[model samples]
Target: MAGFFSRSVRATADEDAGSDEAPLRPIAASDAVRRVELLDSFEAAGLGWFWATDAQGRLIYLSDNASEKLGWSDGEAIGKPLGELFIPERFDDPNKTQRPLVFLLSARNSISGLNVRLAFTKEEVWWEIAGKPQFDEKGRFTGYRGSARDVTASRESDLNAERVAQFDPLTGLANRERLTTRLTETLTSYRNSKRACALLTLDLDRFKQITDTMGQQGGDELLKQVAARLEQIVDSEGEIGHLGGGKFQIVQPDVDDRGALGELGQRLIQALSQPYSIDGARAIIGASIGVAIAPYDGLDTKELVTAADLALYAAKGGGRGQYRFYSSDLKNSVQERRRVEEDLRDAIANGQISMHYQPVVCAKTYKVQSCEALMRWDHPENGDVPPAVFIPVAEDIGIIREMGEWALNEVCRQAKQWPVELRVAVNVSPMQFAHDDFAQTVRNALTNSGLDAARLELEITENVFLGDIGRAQGMFAELKELGVNLALDDFGSGYSSLSYLRTASFDTIKIDQGFVRGATEEGNNNAAILTAIVGLADALGMETVAEGVEARDELELVTQRGATLVQGFIFARPMPNEDFVDRLANGQQTYEARGPAKYRAARKTVFRRIGLIHEDNRYKVVMRNLSKTGAMIEGLLEVPLGTQVVLDLGGGQLAVATVRRSKGALQGVEFENPLISDGAEGLCTRHRVSPYQIEAAGRPLAALPQDPYSLIMGEQEGAGSPRQFVEVEVGTPKPGTGY
Candidate 1:
């Protein structure tokens, strides 16, 4: 009911007596009163709010309407501190973009259209406020006055715009720009503290084929599902972003453990590779991951991203559905892959590719029942090229279809020449299986070679069910009508479905090699799984083939588990077509297992030079074999058992171990901590030497060096002791020769 500030605040300020400009003219008494009424009317209309705080920053007077809007009466707000009026919402969330309102006010600075949140409201409400510090005519401090207007609608609109810019519209995951910003900021902040982070880039395999088969909308739904699965796996450990279609990026801060990052990558690939149902359509797509750790791989955003991308390229080249860690030689590896892919284009025409047969023997009688035709590619320079490497390349270059048809015809032709009653099985790729004329192709193969349909077994993997299930079922019926037997290949590897067994008339289920490899390991449940698979197959009137039975113990275990057929190196390595016929003519139809009697810890045969450190002395030695728990190293003649040492396995990896066994210059050392899977077919140490440690020892921060100890070890470290053992020269060991 009392007087308030004048209508034109600047005009009122001009009425100061000591101002430089002439100001003798002033408003009359009634006009001044009218201006006060106008100011009150402005507040009454709710267009804006008026507020005044004491010199102590406490509220003296507040707009009645603004107070009422916040569920507060003037009595409730008048005596409250100005800071208590606005409390910011969650800073990490999208609603908050302002924080300087209180800081500017506390500093007695002019606030111009500053945004702040209003507290004590049931819902979030934002206001744009402006104020100036008040003073007496003598310049003594007094309470301040300011104006505020509701900006919640505008604020919400701005937030929506930001979200649209920062997140993928389809998947609701962070978009590329936001991801880049986040990685850049993280790397920048971490660099000063000498911390570590990791980047993992993913590319979805078979995504284009799936999209073509399922249509655009279905493809979009699949991307959303992928994002959901990523969130479930990554959770809060890192940030996930959709870097455009079918490509994703993950940033993990304060994490440099390769073992842990490798596990995360593996889980991501496995989860993404599983079957997805999109609007009644089932699909399967794989993921390839590339990993790069900060400082070791790169120190900045561009270098790290480039390194990760190169690693991803290598992963896909090695074979999709795999993950690869960044290495300095990855550029060379990628170039080698391109060369291999190019050479594969003319392989079949040049006679560089041929067929070899590995027999599928009966588990009980140990007699050859059938043969699985494995393809071989002999590059002029590379000699023998693995199917695992070339097959994926063929598929990528669109040559697998022609090659698959060739294999089918060649197998039939070869089987016709066999004097024995051996049915030959041929592998089928998913891309070839998806063709509408695949059944016709098989028909042509059988007719061309004058071979019976029953003698041709077509091996199909779970990937064949990637697209339309009904369409796949139709293909199955057509193939069955052609009288060619079908066997599920790589069963239990992934995407196993009993519904497939129901609809498709598969004659056999070939258990994946992975199940057989670890069946005999202690505490492993693979035996039970093998038995269950056999039981299931038997109940369905189908035979089961246990694959990869190398050792005699694996052979006996598969037999005991009720597997009807077995295939692997224990029986014999795959022989050429000429040798296959020779063997049949020579009456060598039965195979007795020739592998080691019992299974031991699986160790990979390797031949690489490594550094063995004992005390202050480092010795260059050859590592012949490596396993999770131990490795065989050669050098340092007559090394004592139980002596502690460290193995430098490159890339700054140092494994602490104790010698468990010794034979002359060769020593078998057991690791204090076992190595873990590197998200692929290799094992790596869990932790590596941080470059910061090297920097702390007086070197500038940089990427990992070939020998980190050279930078970390002090000069006096060499004065500790002389060499304790004699160094022996290591000759190159022949392949398959035990240390």
Candidate 2:
């Protein structure tokens, strides 16, 4: 080894002296031998490793000590491809232009401080290597020499720092910075291709309540669980990022269709809104999503993020557990929501809220067994305000508890006037139920109303179980001791667990309307879920009520699934107190199912102005209700039946339809194709006119403007034909005719 090292040193010195003008001193053979020994000693000490590769890139020599450190036997790495021995580290940054070791070797380029991960190691090992390309006297490639050192320890620390910069410490999800960078890159890339991307900005609703009840550590744990659930939902569809606190963002590329986007958003809300167990305590939280699509809502990251934020604000304001799509009107909607929030405080304080009751009747007997009390607000200026609009505002403004207590008292008082056989159920919010004296609140309401505790049923949602489980159990026990019936409302709606049935004492399980809404449809799993829930309830000696049975097929399905009670529009719409009392006065305890005999497409009542296009002539009309299959419209005069028209439903959605039923100014139009779920609670056409298409037609790609039909028509040749139908005032009554 000493003689070989001395010869190698002399050859290297001769080669170097030849390249320079200065002459090098000749070394003594004995001194050169000693120097070789010294080099051998240094290699044995493991200070560093020397390696050489052949022209074909196969390893020719490696330090014996280094081979042992890498868990390789002596001569094991010899003749193996050097590049195959290690894999280069890949950087995720799109700006990185680093090439692999094979590329450098093939190009005969010098490598310096290049990091690569060793292959087939029990533990991750990284090596930082430097090598210079070698050449023969004829300039032909020969081999390469390199020095290598183990960088595993330092590389780990570097990776840890990078992870910290990119991910949330608590949830292990991409951090805000990463999300922003990703969104920016996605928007920039998609803009050139004219592709679509979606952004869902969400924040946990009532998260502070959980933190206040369970402390910060528990909140952190809950966030981790939430992150896990979101990952499960998103799976390869896109990326999920933690935006600090309880806020999160999801980026999905090429997902512009409202139907798919809406489905994804709803799935996120439903999954995250379910109950969570931290340690031994249960915590309930909900999420609201504001969704914005690139190229439609905005073309840049900041613009899209702002649009999504506004949509999320609207969703939270509408109700805490819903999702909303970004629209041009969302900005105004946010301001209007603030006004509603202010008015809600006064409404709760001034007793401006009222209750309406919908009966839950026996499936077999069709006799009214109980009625669920629903809260309604009749604002002096706003007229009729939907509970979905005001309830969340009340909760946010700290008026929910007061409003709930008022409703409980009012329901109990009203129940006292009903027949003794009838029971009244009042909806209980989790926030209101979490009060220290919730059981006492119930007792007081019953006492003040002079109503029997047996006749007053408190309908609590699964959300009530989210908190300290023991405390919730205690509250349930105390309420049960007061002789009031307890019903679990919206069972199996979100984060459902059989453990809830085992531990919590509930008298009934009301299947969520979501399950019952389309249970009868083919391929829908709701029927199976409904059956399982009813079986679970029956096995637990609890009754089951199926809510939202709007059609006869739904009624039949729920009844066959062994649900004991039914409640929905199929039985009757919630009636005012006077109307409810009048029915009782007339001995109308048994209500017959009077909805559509067969299942029909669900229709949403929407009274908004829309454009109706016929033969290039666009007419102003009001859409009264919209469904997947068709829509009922008014505000157009004397439209003949079977007239083909296109209804512009805004946001570039156009529904080609034929007037099926036309009488006077009102008509029912059947869509040429069915609409799909918009991902929240609405329906939309599957396809919309792309902004690119609009741009090619010389119209700017911006937020959809009012009367899209007019813009589309203006671009067509000879689109100035006079309208065929007269536009009637929306709210004005037609003379000598009832619409």
Candidate 3:
């Protein structure tokens, strides 16, 4: 074959030579045959393959070796378009500047080391192909001749290296570098078109406890499970990336609506907080998320990330297992958190903390069976501080163990003074429970207070199981030996694991308030969950307590579900020790279930000034408490019922509400539409005043300013209208006025 091709090439050269040009020399047939044999040996060695295309860009020739490697018979790949046979690699280059293969073929340009995938092959095959355009004597396009080498092996290695650089090895999610690049590109592109994007930053709560308890291998496995859950929840909505050490970031484009973002955040929290089974051991963890939307929270990547971080810090500070949206006040909240952390260290030492008790009653008899001890703080300068605010700070500041020990001792002493039948349940922190001498500490408290071990119940959460199983079981044994009852508090709240019940001996299970709050609502599976939990407890010979039974309907549901004990405001609120003792001494042991007929949305107590817009007038009022569907406000007098008003809650959040109940200076207003979670423990309106609107109102486009209402009002001239009612100062009251 080579001898014949050499003669033909000489003949063609002779034919094309002009009269003035020298004729080309023809090779000897013997040397030509030797060269042909050498070429055949090269093709046989599988070093490369030769291919040719006709003027029409269709394959005319394919090497026999290449055809065989692709599982194709001889001449099978011929007549197909070269572009169709081999497609350009879909894995984009980091620079993202490569031209399409079709364009190069159409332009008949020279291709050098162009990597492509063999589309016709059953197995994945990559080739490094090089070709040059061929022309006829008239300088017209004729065909292309190319050589291709199988690069599947080298390409696989390259891809593996790229994956290591671009993704987290343990979780197989995008790494920080890749996420940063993607975020920068997305923000740049979205900026030009005025599009919106949302970024959620999340960090796992109590992850450190898991890492310390389980080995690093266990932590890695837990992260893989977390990544799987995140992927399932996010699906195709956005991209998720691991930011190292239990932190993750998600970018969802065209999702700036607070309602949708809030829902997504909540789903993530719920999914991550579920129990994780790693290597036959049960683990529970929680997630805190911070969300920031483009053009409102920030306009650039750096600013947006900073905003999201601040929001996440606030969410974790508010108490983990929640999400928060970026707000202007978060900066101040950070400094306030720092101050609170410092103050918390002194709170325990100065005796500013106290324990209050709420009774848990028998569901059938309504007789007080036990009381759960709750921690309360009275800051010297800041006044009363709720546990939700100070407890997380205490945990972070390394004072929770001290505080927990104090509470245990105090509760035991108080319980000794009560009737022998009444038990005292003290909540134990995971940090304190993991201590080497925790059981000993409990024993000492019991002995010192002269409190019977049978009457002392130590409430523990699922987090205690996150550490060494042997240690946790040993602690349980020690506690049991001391004769104290053990109850699983906040059961089904984090990592709801039935396996724990099998492995650890729990005397009781306290149902979380989350399930109880919505158990009676239609379409809520919590009612069924309650029944199942009660049955499970019964099978285990453990008592069940229904927590947070705030309404008569909820009480009825729990009672019907056969819960052993009921606890919540429907019976009574947590009272000071003095009040509790006084009531016990008065023999007020039985209480009637008196509460609202049906469950209502939980309300948050707040004391902040807000702008109340009525018609063209804006009045300053104080929002005393807020819920998803309504709020109680003060400072406006003689406001008629059903009067429409808009409440400016700052940061561009405005809620349209109507006065449902009006009194002398206080009114209860119902929202026209229900509020949504602000990604944290707060409620917010679905939509906010857009920066575009502010720009159109003659201001630069920027984040929400301090006074969005003033921007909307655009400088009112004069005292617009006479004050309809006198403004009463907050914290002051008229002698005869009442709400």
* Candidate number with greatest TM-score: 1
Give the C-alpha lDDT of model 1.
0.87
Per-candidate alpha-carbon RMSD to the true structure: 4.7, 5.9, 6.0
**Please, what are the lDDT tens digits per residue for candidate 2 over residues 1-739?**
1212433554554456555567655556677654775676577677768888889998888887778877888788788888888889897555565889989988989999999988878888889999998989999888899889888889899889988999998998999998999889878877778888899999998888888889899889999999999999999778899988889999988988777877878788878877777887777888989988888788788999999999898788766788888877777886788788777778756767888989999999999888889998877766778887887878887888988888898888888887545888899999898899989899999889899898888888877777788888899899989999989988877777787788878899999998987678889999999988988888999999998888899999998999999999988999888899888888999998988877766688877788787886777789989888999999888989889998998878899999999998999999998888644567777667677766666788765554455665565623567677888888833322100
Scanning candidate 2 in windows of ten residues, the lowest lDDT window is 1-10
- List clashing residue pairs in candidate 3: 275-495, 323-679, 323-680, 324-679
Model 3 per-residue lDDT tens digits across residues 1-739:
1211233334444465677667655556766554564565566688988888999999887777888877887678788889887778764333466666677889999988999888877788899988999999999998898889999999899889989999999999999999888888888777677778899999999888888888888899999999999999998778899999999999998887899898889889998988888888778889999999987898888989999999999899888898999988888887888888888888777988898999999999999999899998888777778788888988988889999999999988888887545888999999999899999999999999999899999999888877577889999999999999999999987666777899888999999998899889889999999999999999999999999998999999999999999999999999999988888988999988989999877899888889888777788899989999999999998899889988998888889999999988899999998999775567888888877677778887677776866776687622477656567777844332100
Tens-digit per-residue lDDT, 173-241, candidate 1: 999999898888888888888789999999999998888888898889999999999999999889999
Model 2's alpha-carbon lDDT is 0.83
Cα misplacement distance, residue 53 of candidate 2 (Å): 4.7
Residue pairs of candidate 2 with colliding backbone atoms: 262-679, 282-467
- TM-score for all models, in order of appearance: 0.92, 0.83, 0.84
Better of 2 and 3 by lDDT: 3
> How many clashing residue pairs appear in each of the predictions shown?
0, 2, 4
lDDT of each: 0.87, 0.83, 0.86
Q: What lDDT score goes with residue 489 in model 3?
A: 94
